[model samples]
Target: MVIHGREPDWSYVARSVVKVLTVTAALLLTLTVGERALEVFVDVGDRTAQVYGTAARIANPDKRLSHGYTHSGRLPVTTFTMRGEPRRAGPSDGTTEYKIVEGLFGTVQAPLLDGPSGSLADAIDSVEAKPGDGRARATLDGLPPTLVGVGVVEFAHKMTTEQLVAFGRRHKICGGDDVAYIYEPSFYDDSSDPSSLNAIVWNRDMTREDDWAEFAYQCETEPERALAEFRRWVGLLDENDDLEEFELAYGSLKGAADEGVTYGLVFDRWKLADLRKLLDDPDVGTIHLADVAFDLDTWTG
Candidate 1:
């Protein structure tokens, strides 16, 4: 799932864009204005690579990002006598009543290749959606992409910045919600149409804003060490949700230090051997894996 930026509250997904939280008077030290690039160059004995990122703009510190979007589609009218997890996500009057609404913006992109892969919707409903994680991409009818739809998985799933940016390039307009670590796949919509999408623009600019920090640096370390560092980082922010958004969503919290590999485009065709092309193609971006063996551990940059 891609991170759609909020004006002041930029918190989206981890490895996606970051929400610039409110730096209370007591936590001003973490806030700074400087001209240094947030670059990372991982150069262990066996691997070497460069990472480049512009400084995250801390604009409108006093104002939070707006959640303004045109409402589209109809809230699912099919009511159900809620039970299990669905009950908790529904109206909480201690009654077992709930509605299965379309995505925050609306229903799944009309027509379907695989149909509405209810994982994102289910997560929003606080139900545990399984193996059907990742994204569900669809375009209006059989068209080229005046509108595109995607489904982002929850904590027990995987969402990558590369995948998000790939869709952003296909459509000029896009938006997403990162509630409960479950991101509803986003789509592009018209600005003039009040019924069209317009919460956050999902373009390379915003993608850069989300991924710059996460992709900029990574080093070799034991899994336990990396987990400790991540927990500490979350503790420093005192935002446990941030940890969920970043680490838990991808199972990276107790995982090892990442190699920070991301491909320039999104595709399942890539294999571990494909990384050899990185040095051949300067456009390819990544931090070396060294002796750190991995399967198809890559991201679409």
Candidate 2:
């Protein structure tokens, strides 16, 4: 009876074991393939949405107008690591490693002007060089030959006259070629307090004595004037109330020097959107804002 048990159906037992193993292996392979495909699809969809969404937002005029407000918010941080090794024959020695951390909401895009011609420097130069005779001929003489040859001042004059003609030709202000508008955001300090809204004008046409005299006059006579006045006359002010004392900073480069001063401001996402809105307004005319730094990393770097 024991010998009969050992000889029965050995082939059937082998086939059953093989079938079970094949089924289990096929199921595991299918799951693995499905998971990989899902991961790829999700990644692609997310990237496409981010790129397209940002591009669309920037292009929309309603979203791009400038609003005067200080940004005060925190953003999510992303870290990146880079590693590099020098060539064997190179004079430099070792591997280079670096890390970069970026904040998302710290970046803001503000509109400067409606068109490329609304450059702040050009506006200032035009105002400073224009003769009292009400002709831009003197301004043209002071400009570089290249600029004069290209008829930048002539074009500016023509454009100014045309704008005046459209704005009822009579009772229209004519000398706007010399005026420049600038918007700067910075952390407020007691020394250079944002609350004490004031305009800093460098009247190149004014003699040094006159310029100093005018500065003194403004410092004393209108020492504590509102930012609105400053904005209207000189075209700039640190006037937003949402900004706190330590949240804003600013500085400017002297001439064409590479180095410039920088200031910090509290980050605000909503205010940044408002700034874009101001720039997009058609009635604002040729407004210009300069020294805007949206990329915190670049500014800090």
Candidate 3:
């Protein structure tokens, strides 16, 4: 097409061609920008949501201990609960501090257990011994001025929340001389049925010595608070469509208000004598030790 009646002006033709090229470039640039925006906001957002759903499950494969997840900007951070366990494996020199981060992830990446520090395998060692008075007496000699250990006390059968709390009171599982603070209780129903054993731990938030002491006190005086917390977890699980998790949580919560729920108690922190008492109890079916750490400040810090 000719812009003017005169024979096509070369300079005019050149200007028209340049304008068409500029328009095409602009349209392409806009489409590219739109596609990138969609990828970042929509696609990344959906993947992050999926990460949130799987984070807790992946972090806590069996639930003998407590696990939780929270977001840090775009990153998902998962925490495994331990009372005074070292953050990473190291000598009990005063310098080591306990860390809670169990899983950290990116939108497209799987949740990773060990970060730069070390593998959890290196950190948490299984403390093995048959549960009995002999093991209890053996623990008394090695304990430090201040120490933390994870121990599991399995009962012959499932006990209601009331029974567990009463058991705590009867054993005097509180922080003080000759007594160890019960940091949190791991509650599970299908523990005997190894095929589907799932447990839930309560109150990983008690990070400080006083926090644990107070929790131990609450276990005796106001067990209802723990029951309430269990119910709250059930409610939170109800909001999601994860039927497996919901059923497990709900099953634990069932006896919280009425009788109680749990076949055993997983103790996060134990004193020399406290471990002894649990081991000596005829009602306790078995005791599983996870690991121990010396120096309380490092854990509380």
Q: Which of the numbered candidates is closest to the native, going by highest TM-score?
A: 3
Ranking by lDDT: 3, 2, 1
lDDT (tens digit, per residue) of candidate 2 on 1-301: 4555467697998899899999999988878756644533433223222221222221211112111112222423333232333211112345444322322322222232111222323332233234324233333343332210111111122222223234222322122212212222111237753443211221112111121344332221121121223323222212321112112222221110112111111111111222333223332222222222243333457
Every candidate's lDDT = 0.22, 0.26, 0.41
Tell me how far the alpha carbon of residue 115 in candidate 3 is from the true structure, in angstroms, after superposition.
16
Tens-place lDDT digits, model 1, residues 1-301: 9999757633445324322343353255433211111110111100100000100001101111221112222332211111211111112243222122122211222111111123322222222322322121111122222212122212222334354344233432123221111122222235532222101111122112233254321112221222333343323221222211111222231121232212122111122233232223323222111111122223222
lDDT of 3 by residue, 210-270 (tens): 2234434354634455556445444443322222321233344344434445545545555
Give the C-alpha miss distance for residue 267 in model 3, angstroms. Answer: 2.0
The global Cα lDDT (0 to 1) of model 2 is 0.26
Clashes per model (N, Cα, C within 3 A):
11, 35, 5
Cα deviation of 71, candidate 2, in Å: 12
What lDDT does candidate 2 reach at residue 126? 35
Q: Give the lowest summed-lDDT range of ten residues in model 2.
A: 260-269
C-alpha lDDT of candidate 1 relative to the true structure: 0.22
Q: Could you tell me every candidate's TM-score relative to the true structure?
A: 0.18, 0.18, 0.44
Residue 141's lDDT in candidate 1:
20
